[model samples]
Target: MNSDKVLDARGLACPMPIVKTKKAINELETGQVLEVHATDKGAKADLAAWSRSGGHELLESAEENDVFKFWIKKG
Candidate 1:
């Protein structure tokens, strides 16, 4: 998906990725997408839940080469 900004949260631990994602998404206007790259395994579930709770849309997520990528659209 197209993204307005990309945040590299790779190598970060639990909560850190979510924390950074929150900050990054906050910077975007509604409907803009934020792409997050993280190494934390928990980031997938964390980000999904976070996005829903924050009224944002978790557009897509995937893992490749041990990196987890997520696209979130600001609500």
Candidate 2:
């Protein structure tokens, strides 16, 4: 997925990824996408819930080489 900005949160733990993601998404306009790269094991669930709670759309997710990638569209 295409993103307006990419956040490299790899090696960051829970809440940290979510924290940075929140900050990154805030810099985007509505309908823009934020692509996040994280290594946190809990990032999948954390980000999924965070996106839902914030009314953002989690467009796509994948695990590549132990890294979790997410494309979130700002709502």
Highest lDDT, which number? 2
Per-residue C-alpha lDDT of model 2 across residues 1-75, encoded as one tens digit per residue: 778999999999888999999999999999999999999989999899999999999999999999999999999
RMSD of every prediction: 0.6, 0.5
TM-score of 2: 0.97
Candidate 2: RMSD to truth: 0.5
Clashing pairs in 2: none
What's the lDDT for candidate 2? Answer: 0.96
Residue 40 of model 1 has an lDDT of 89
Provide the lowest-lDDT 10-residue window in model 1.
Answer: 19-28
Off by over 4 Å in 2: none
Task: Summarize candidate 1's per-residue lDDT along 1-75 as a digit string, tens digits.
Answer: 788999999999998999889888878899999999999888888899999999999999988999999999999
For model 1, the superposed segments whose C-alpha errors exceed 4 Å read: none
